[model samples]
Target chain A: MTETLTAPAPETHPRYAIEIDGVGKTYGSGDGAVTALDLVNLDVRKGEFISLLGPSGCGKTTLLRMIAGLEDPTQGSIWLPGRGLDGLGFVFQRDALVNWRTIIENVLLPLEFKGRRTKAAYQRARDLLATFGLAEFEDRNPWELSGGMRQRAAICRAMIDDPQLLLMDEPFGALDALTRDDLNFELQALWPDPEKTAVFVTHSINEAVYLSDRVVVISDKPGRIVDITEIPFERPRPLEIREEPEFGRIARHLRGVLDGHSARRA
Target chain B: MKKNPLAYIPMQVWTIVGIFAVWQACVMVLDIKPIILPPVPKVLGELFGNFGLYLRHGGHTLGNTLIAFAISVVAGVGMAIGIVYSKFLEKTLYTLLVTVNNVPKVALAPLFVIWLGTGNASKIAMGVLISIFAIVIDTVLGLRSLHPDLIDLGRAMRGSEFKVLMKLRLPNAMPSILAGMKVAISLALVGAIVGEFVAAQNGLGFVILSSQGAFRTDRVYASIIVLAAIGTALYYMMEYAEAKLIPWHESRRSHARPTAPSKPAKGPVAQPVASDAKA
Candidate 1:
């Protein structure tokens, strides 16, 4: 972590919220080293929604973790502007809700940690849970809620403090298809707020195409970005759009590039 | 299926009733001498008749057990936390504890008596010596058992290590800590009894030992019954504390069933929230 110095994108105004410059990651050294990521570069504009889509072991998660500041790139650097990396909300594949806390308390946890919890903060947490259809379950423990509800609670927690950036790692990957569909809609509903940027990592091509403004395909083993396909579709896209021929074509195109990099993936 | 917990009362009562029946049956059928095996009525009479005497010694035993157990709880959990947060302590203190625990703790009773003298200090020290291991070992395991995702989440939130330890780690370790306490409390009681056996002049253990020496077999039986009651009480007290403290834990949840029903299912069942399978 101490070895690399991140230089900001050469832009003066900082149009990009995140600038990932030729980042690479290698674990260990000498005899038994493993390169998890190759020299990968990406720039996500402010308010952009991007998905790093690839099969497992493609180091997509590793890349996402680097962006979240949980890991450091072995080379190059990631420069996060605006709120920077510290002021961000993160959702894990598992709900990762603190089971002992009531849903509201879990949501307020980050704020509490920040020493910023106030009466208004509590209200904000309540409103966020209510928006996620979890108002009634606010006082209930995480284990008492269904999987989808628990994840919604987790999302509420992530959003409670109005973080400028959101990082989600396969947030809906564990749920049933119907529940996943529900959450996807819920997420899309809130995505238009306040130029907040999000970097999502997922293995599902459909999820990438459906939710992201652009899909970045990554190759397996020493993951490198193979393609970045921008969606031409309009905002607040209805679920019916996925039925369109163009949507299928775009999804298939991303999948084809992903498949080209490694083996075929569902 | 578990509508009324009261339904299990008869089951519990009958099991105890059945054990007493077996005891009485053995006494009658074996034709044991009255001095050797007091009849149920005689023993019960001795218990009620000498309730004051039992109460006095019982109080002494209970007091020593609780004081020693409290000290062990504080020291044991403290040591566990220390071991978890410091590799130095983990390497030295924890390793030493593991080695020390393998020795029979009762064998150390005379040592405590010699070192701390034949008073509450030695008795309490013995109780702590016998019981502290479970707390340290279990609490350490529980503290280290946090899901890695939780650690990452803590980091993602920029939570300080101390904040994470206090708010997340400690609460998560509570169930394990309480479990250790349950075992420790019983062991503490046993330690106090061993201390009393080695040198003490009072308490239930001394009562039992002295009564046996005088061939007052009924008093010995009475003191034992009281001791059993105390051990059972301590265990259940710990269980009650565990249930109250961490009812959300899966192990404690069956006892805390959601009897209030769902919160009237708000929001439409068909949430328009699902974005049309978007592109």
Candidate 2:
């Protein structure tokens, strides 16, 4: 594990932790080319929870994948100061747990890959599982767990390494409404640790408003960022917050943005 | 109600017994010539009477089959790995393999005998040639058919290329490789038999050939029985290995039989957690 490097100038307090400048991704070439993301630029501050809220085929996932270093932008650049691949974690839309391994083994997989499977790492895995209500099911296969439990376990797997930045691509999209709500709250409770930052991608307007500090909404068809809304709700938000006037207002605004995009495209 | 364990025998077992009884009754009622269609009793008698001779020849056949199967597994898996790791090998070697596999293996039996001599070497060679392609194709398919999400997870975890292959890809491919092994084992037996048919002094194939020449239909039937038993045993052995190795696999899980029925008197069983019916 790498230590967090102190910011060079404390007075300035680096406004952006990550800088994505004019990044564009085009797939293939020569008449067969398709642009996934076009001139998308966004900056994320340290320890902020940002959601890339968009409709399908909006390049949100493609953008997330690029941030995770799984893919590279064909144009422009993305810069994360004093961060390496080891400091990043990803939670996919599907549980993505290795079917053959136990929950604890899956959680400890990143450590295993780094050849750093110490006793402390095992303890950390157990602790994370316990936190996620998966302690008793550590030895069970992924198939044996419910969808919610599996996704929770996946979250544990991602966070076990104590990544500074967590990239989640619709991590709760496959779950039922009730399970998705519970997990959204769980995620909210988990994201407050000041050292951790998160970039969440989702199609749910309510989810973006409920959990994100800011929602970056993108439009489809050579996807580009249309708006970045700053959410004013405080940390550790309660479920009742959803029923509040401000929450409804934010959700409605995001829904309008999405509906307007679709209407115009049609 | 307590049921008799004997009554729990599979339907296939009962069907086989019925077929044998019908065969015996046909020979008796029709008064068929012993030379034409020998009675089941006579075949059983020959099998039991020449038990030692049968055992020696069966051992030779089994040895040839096993040695050939082992070689095919190693070479096939090796080739699969090579093909999977290299696009050039997949394009060139895979086509050649498929073409060679399509050729009639029995036609090549005499060629193997000529090259490796009329001994265990020839039999093993025939087995390798006959069985290797299925193993290669099945294993290659398994290795390549990994779930994309799993690959992405591995990459996100920073697994090296070697680590991905060893931990993620190989284990994911095990069930397919085992399926291929089961198919290859049966083909291996056929190859050994074909080689023995071309030229051999020992083995069940040799016994059957010599008995047919001497007009001993019962011995021929006995030799065939031994061959069937060997094939069935090898197949089940492969199945048992597959069950043990990949119990997590859907095929193995679906095949698992409940040890005992739940007691209806106890009412509905309470699950510890809400089972994800949709999952």
Candidate 3:
């Protein structure tokens, strides 16, 4: 993947958090070998919420996984200079809440694994739960809650570690449209730090437009970026921004680019 | 409306009475001999008359069954953990469990008696052999059927395998494991009886055998009734524990707490007939 970003504006390199250079990932070998990503390159500025938007088999999830350190890239390197990515938190498509653990306890799981299970860690977990409107459900198991509630608890767990980077893989895809919108707003409100970097993979074009500062559109099969549209909306973007002509224009323009790529592949 | 929990007791009593009434009528109309078809009252009288004898044998058999059932639970869960932790062990051990489980456990009763003698040891072993299959099969399935996503989540959170088992797999599998134990309890009871039939000095199975040899059919049936009660009680106790431990599980929660009515009717016009018609 070759990156040819025209002229680098000062805003473009915010903090130069992640530099993906010519990463190619291939699975299996011989008849079974599948090239999921081919010649992929991208740069994520610090504190920016970037959405890797693509169709199925486009290696969007693979790219997100590589950034999260869940999968090693076959060719390129992923570096998190500031705070080190070993402390990165991930929110999965499924809630991934341990069914046996209560909501608060599930949120505290990262601390337990990291051997930082002090009383203060627990207090922080409870504080996070309260922020998410889950104080009353702190003692409730995952199965006892509704799907939306479970996903809320999942977000709390993901943020429990308070890492510099948060990797999300279609976190709100399984939710209903109404719940998904509510969560999107909730996420924007509780993003921890304005300068905290986030890499999200999603199939929904609208979700990409709503949650991301830059939407990285990718092609199918040998996944490679076709376009990176920078969203110019102001900070603390309210749901009302969706009705603005600029937001609609960018969204439509990205859709047209995606359509063209699909046409070429066909 | 609240469902009266007591409703089923009266239904059960009526069903039992109907069965006896049909039996009594058949015996009287057919003029069957008392030896062939003793009256229900006579059977009950014999059961109470020989209560001590029945209790002694019943206690022996129930003790053996309980012993076997307990061993099965421990061994099954242990084996399940072993198989899940290692793929090679699972492949080899699970194949053996399946093969042994498929073999009719009753066929092994005589061998057990020969090896362990005509004592409680053989009877307990026989029962264990019968019930172990259920525990192993269910526990393995429960352990292996955990969602892959949950495992990945645990790994992402940097959990050790031991922690994952303790915090996730074991608790998630509780309902299924309890279900398997309930099924095994009945089989364990049956196995004890079969062991007694093969060779035993005591137990309900021996009592039934002796009564049959003497042609005392009433005593035989009475022993059977006692055995059935014991088995039912054990199964329900497991069900009760399962309901308590996994209250969040859908199957358990629905039955754990009785639901309150949505709201009481406002008027006397909301009678049974009106409600039925509306339904």
TM-score of each: 0.92, 0.90, 0.86
Q: 1 or 2, which is superior by TM-score?
A: 1
Please state the i-RMS of candidate 2: 8.9
Q: Give each prediction's root-mean-square deviation over alpha carbons.
A: 6.0, 5.7, 8.1
In candidate 1, stretches whose alpha carbon ends up further than 4 angstroms from where it belongs are A1-13, A264-266, B1-9, B255-279
Q: Write the per-residue lDDT of candidate 1 for residues A1-266, one digit (tens) a residue.
A: 23223455466346787888899999999989999899999989888888999889889999989888889888888888766766689998887787678989999999888888999999989888889888788898766666778788889988887877899999888777777877888887776655788889999988888888889999987789999999877778787888999999998898779777884542
Query: What local lDDT does model 2 show for residue A106?
Result: 88
Winner by TM-score:
1
lDDT-better candidate, 2 vs 3: 2
As for candidate 2, its clashing pairs are none
User: Which tens-of-lDDT digit does each residue in B128-168 have in candidate 2?
Assistant: 99999879988888888777777788878887888888888
Over 4 Å off in model 3, which ranges?
A1-21, A80-86, A113-118, A141-144, A192-195, A263-265, B1-9, B253-279
> Which prediction has the highest DockQ against the true structure?
1
User: Where is the poorest 10-residue window by lDDT in model 2 chain A?
Assistant: A1-10
Question: Candidate 2 on A57-170: residue-level lDDT in tens?
Answer: 889999998887788888877766645566889998887787678889989988888788999999999999999777788988766667788788889989988888899999
- Of 1 and 3, the candidate ahead on DockQ is 1
- What DockQ does every candidate get? 0.39, 0.32, 0.20
lDDT of 3 by residue, B202-278 (tens): 99999889999999999888887898789878988887887677665655445434322122212111111101110
